[model samples]
Target: MALAMTDASMTDATITLPAIAPRHARDGKLRRMLSRMAILVITMVLVVPVGLVALGSGAGVIALPYEMFELARRAPLLFPAHMIASALVLLLAPAVILTRRRPEFHRPLGRLLGLFVVIGGLTALPVAIISHSTPLARAGFFAQGLVWLYLLGAAYVAIRARDIPRHAHLMTAMVAVTTGAVWFRVITGTAIALRLPFEPVYAASAWLGWMLPLALVLSNPRAFARLLSR
Candidate 1:
């Protein structure tokens, strides 16, 4: 026979539900490592080709070549300068983010990343100015460059003022903008490979690439939050 508990009996009885298992610490670290590696891999695949094309297009340079060579041939200094610095910005942004907790490493890498950002932003102006593409495309890239420099400057001020949280957010946003270059190439490449219309794809990629990344980063940067914040 089952005995039903009275109200007094039930009040005196202790009830325990099953406890939820905590996530393992190593699992989190491994996830972070994997995420960082994925970013680096994407950076290598996209940015490296530009670097190679920029560096190796000279008569005797003898490097793995690509279409950006036209830029190398055209403006020579301006295009190549923008590309190389932009590549460095893409590469070092991750490194700087990853090294946030390690002041010893972060300082130097952050400085280097900032320098490249400045160079890349400055050079982008002329490249955007001289681009033969439609005015909309030129304006998009020019605005992107301006925004990049603005974010970099703002982040610098935040850090200088010891506003760690604001600095973290700004730097992450800046890094997202830096990664936009990679997204730009990816979208452009995919569109071309699919035989999509050129002008529309190219022009859209100019803004969409960065805007998409910037939106994603601002919305859910928790994946890299550990690295993004000290």
Candidate 2:
């Protein structure tokens, strides 16, 4: 009787051990799945605007004489820096995508992108201040300059602290802001496609593209609580 009771207890423990381990493993798997889904959804949201801008009437329809004239007319003193920054930002997109799989490639590529952002911001700042564009355009340019400054500062801090999370957050913010032009074009194209009113839509899109991600970062529970408490 005693031996039988001991054997039963040992059996129960053995059975329960596997069950407990599996439960924890399942929880971890679920968490990972959710994280991946969040990243995928965000990626798609960002990618769609860029893809549309590159494919639609925005920059894609190059032969449209009126569009060319408009682009040329708006090409201000900061146009060259804007073009360079825009090109670098676009180039970094592929690197970022590639880094999703090959994370080892991320640091070097990120550092390069950081350098480009700094140069872009420094060159573009003066132009933005002196730009004689609409109030909205000036605001956009100023916002972009601030984003670039943040990116540069964040990258420096990340390097100093060896904090990957901070590095990623800053890079995400940089991409979000740098892609405003693409979003602007996308909003305009989308409006035209849907036969909706254009001017308001474009303005709304530009502002949202600049503000939304920053808002998301700020509104994150961890960050928000800290910010609000302070």
Candidate 3:
């Protein structure tokens, strides 16, 4: 009778442990999926306006890339290079973030993204100051560029020091700053749609483009914490 009871207890323990294991695995996967969806949704929200503007430009609504070329025509060649790099960063950063599923591919793509962000931010500083129309706009863009560079540098240092959690959060922050390039266009487009005054709209966008994303991070620390923890 004693041996039979012990065997029954052992069987119950084995069955319960396996049941808990599957639930934990499922919970982990669900968390990862939710986090990925949130990041991608935020990314699309930022990119859609900029994408529409680009499509319109290509269709001759805004005047192609020529309109931008005209604005920075007198600026150094770096201005165009910066614009191109900005476009690449917008495309690559989200991809880097999403490629978490396949770390082998993620590694190469991540390097490409890091390279573009560094180049884009560095090139933007000069273009913003020398080529932008208003003093306020220039200052705003310059500050955004500085924040982008700083975040990317911090992320690199974190990874180098084997601080994975710090690296993850900083990279997310860097991506947020990169999206500022997109948000600038979106804000400008909204202002135009509203027929608001050009100067104020442009100036407001310069600061808001970058600040809003950081604000979101600060507001939802737990979501970001879980994402990096994973």
TM-scores of all predicted structures: 0.77, 0.62, 0.74
Question: Model 3 over residues 159-222: C-alpha lDDT tens digits?
Answer: 8898977787888887777778777777898898999998899888989988998777767766
Q: In model 1, which runs have C-alpha deviations exceeding 4 angstroms? A: 1-18, 21-74, 221-223, 226-230
lDDT of 2 by residue, 79-184 (tens): 4545555556555765664574466797677677777677667756665555554567656667777776787687579868987656656666666666666666
Clashing pairs in 2: none
Clashing pairs in 3: none
Off by over 4 Å in 2: 1-77, 94-104, 123-133, 221-230
Error of 1 at 142 (Å): 0.8
- The ten-residue window of minimal lDDT in model 2 covers 221-230
- Predicted candidate 1 versus true structure: per-residue lDDT over 1-230, tens digit per residue: 12455754555553321221224556776777787777677666865565454434333265523545555566788876787788777656656866888899998999998998999899998888887778888888998899899989998999999997778888888877876777787888899899999899889889888888788878875655774432
Q: Output the TM-score of candidate 2.
A: 0.62
Ranking by TM-score: 1, 3, 2
